[model samples]
Target: MFFASDNSGPVPPQVLAALTEANTGYAMGYGADAEMVEVTKRVREIFEAPEAAVHLVATGTAANVLALATLCQPFETIFCTPTAHIHEDECNAPEFYTGGAKLTLVPGLPGFDDKMTAANLRATIAKEETRGVHGPQRGPVSITQVTERGTIYSLAELQELTTVAKEFNLPVHMDGARFANALVALECSPAEMTWKSGIDALSFGGTKNGLMGVEAVIFFDPKKAWEFELRRKRGGHLFSKHRYLSAQMLAYLTDDLWRDNARKANENCAYLAEGLRRADAPFLHEPQANMIFAALPRATHQRLFEAGAAYHLWDGPLDGDPNEKIAARFVCDWAISRDQMDHFLALIA
Candidate 1:
C-alpha cells in the first residue's frame, strides 16, 4: 500500500495515450506547438478567463516561481504562511527566481498548522512597507488552497484574505499545487476559487493529479504575459520539446479527467479517514482532500511498516514505547484502491 505521496502514483492511461499521439507527428518547438495552442485555449475556457495567459512548465516549482517572479519585483517581499510550499519545500527557488525577493511568512493561529487568518495577514502586511525605501516593500499575497497540513481554505476565508490584500493594493497568487483536489473538496467552480475570489494568478497544477510532469501558470490579467515568458526562459524552465508538456495538460483538462481523478483521491482519503476514526485514532486536522494527518500507537505503526504500508510520520518516533501515540501523514492518490486502504486499516487494528 503506497501512501507516501500523490507524486508517487502512476500516470493515467489517457495521459500516456495523449503523449503517444503527440509523438507521432512533428510540431513547432517552444510554446509555438499546435498542441500548446490547444492547451492554452482549453485552459482559458476552463478557467472562464478568455484573456488569461497560460504557460506550461515541467514542474510545480517552475510554475510557482515563474508566476511569483512575474508578480513581484526584486526588492519586494512575498507574504505567505510559514508552512507554504514555496517557503518550506521549494528550497529558495522563489527567492532565486524573483532575483532576491524575500518571503515574509505570516504566522498561523496557535493551534493550526500554518493556515493563515485574515487578522494575521492584515497585521503581517501592515508591519511591512513601514521602513519606506529602507525595508522590504510589500508584494503579492500568496495563499495555498490545500495547506501543507491538508486543510483547505474555504471560500469565505479566501475572500477575507484577498480583501485584506486588496486593502493593501497588493496582488494575490495562489499556490494551487493541489488545485483539482481542493476544487473537488470545495465543490466550487474554478473561477469561483480563483479570479472571481480575487486571486490574480494561479499555479494551475496537473502533475500531482495525473500528469507525468507538467504544470500550468495562469495569469488572469495577462498584462505580465511577456515578462513571464522571459522569466521562464531565463530560469531554464522553457521546454524545447514543449508539445509533450502540452499534450499531458491537454489530456488532463479534457474529458473531465482532472475532476474524476480528484474525486477518486478525495473519496479514498475519506474512506481512510473513516477507518482511522473507527480505529480510535486521533486526527490533527480534518481530512479535507486527499491527505490526512492521524495519530496512532507506535506499535501499530510498526506493524503497518512491517506489513509494507508506506507513509510518513508527522511527529514522534517509531522506536518509542509500543503504546505511545505518534502522528503519521497518509496521502491517498487516485490509483489507491479500497483494498489497500482496508489492508492498512486492518494492520493498524
Candidate 2:
C-alpha cells in the first residue's frame, strides 16, 4: 500500500507499448519525428489554439523554466505564491533559467490552501516596477493549478487571477505540473482553463499522471516560439532521441487516456478521503484532486509504516510523542487499487 507519490507509481501499459513501437525505426533527432508532428497537432486541437506552439521536455522543471524564460526578461520578477513549486521545489531553476529573474511572493488568501487571491496579486504587482530601473521590473505572473498544497483553483478563480495580471499588461504562465489532474477535477474544457482564461503559456504535464517522464510546454501565442526553442536547446533540455518523448505524449493524448488516468486518480483520492473522514482524521486541506494532507497521531503513523504503508509526514518527525498528531501527505495515483486503499485504511483503523 504505497501512498507516497504519483511520481513513484507505475507507467501505464499504453505508454510503454507506444515506446516499444517507436523504438523499432530510425527517425530524425531533436523533435523532427512524425510522431512529434502528431503530438503538436493533438495538443493544439485539445487546447483549441490552432496557432499554439508545443514543445516537449523530460522534466516539469525544464518545461516551467524554459517557458518562463521566454516570457520574462532577466531584470523582471515573476509573481507567484509562497508555496508554488517554482518557488519552493524547483531549486531556483526558474531563476537560473530566466537569467536571475526573481520571484515575488503573493500572499495567499487565508484558508484558501495557498491560492493567491486577485486582490493580493494586484497589490503585489502594483508594488513592483515602481522604483524605475533600481528595482526589479514586473514580469510574467505564474499560477499553479493544483497548488503545492493540493487544492485546486476553480475556473472563475483562475480567470480572476489572470485578469489581474492582464491589468498590468503582464504575461500569464501556468505551472501545470498536474495539469490533467486539475483538468479532470474541474470538469472544464482545456481552452476554458487556459487561453480563454488569459494564460499565455502552459506546462502540460504527463509524468505524474502515467507517462515515463515527458512534459509539454505550450505557448498560446507563437510569437516567442523561436526564442523558446533556442532557450530549450541552450538549457540542454532538448533530447536527441526526441521521438520517445513524442511517443509517450501521443499515447497519453490518444483515446482520452490522460483524462481517464487523472479521473481514476482523483476518484481514488476521494475514496481514501472518505475512509479517513470516517476514521476521524483531521484534514489540513480538502482533498481536491489526487493528493491529501491529513493529521494522524504519531502512534497511528507508526502502525501504518510498520505495515508497509508509504507516505510523507508534513509537519514533524516520526519520533515524537505517540499521541501527538502529525500531518502527512497521501497521494493517490492511477495504479493504486481499492484493495490497496482498503488495506491502508484498515491499518489506520
Clashing pairs in 2: none
The parts of candidate 1 lying over 4 Å away from their true place are: none
Mind giving the per-residue lDDT tens digits that candidate 1 earns over 1-349? 9999999999999999999999996888998999889998998888899999999999999899899999999999999998899999999999999999999989888988568999999999999999989999999999998888889999999999999999999999999989999999999999999999999999988888888999999999989899999999988988899999999999998999999999999999999999999999999998899999999999999999999989999888799899999999999899998988898888877
Q: What local distance difference test score does each model get?
A: 0.93, 0.94
Model 2, 95-181: lDDT tens digits are 999999999999986766379999999999999989999999999999998888889999999999999998899999999988999
As for model 1, its CA RMSD to the true structure in angstroms is 0.8
Give all TM-scores, in the order shown: 0.99, 0.99
* lDDT, model 2, position 308: 89
TM-score of 2: 0.99
lDDT of 1: 0.93
Question: Which residue ranges in model 2 land beyond 4 Å of their true spot?
Answer: 111-113
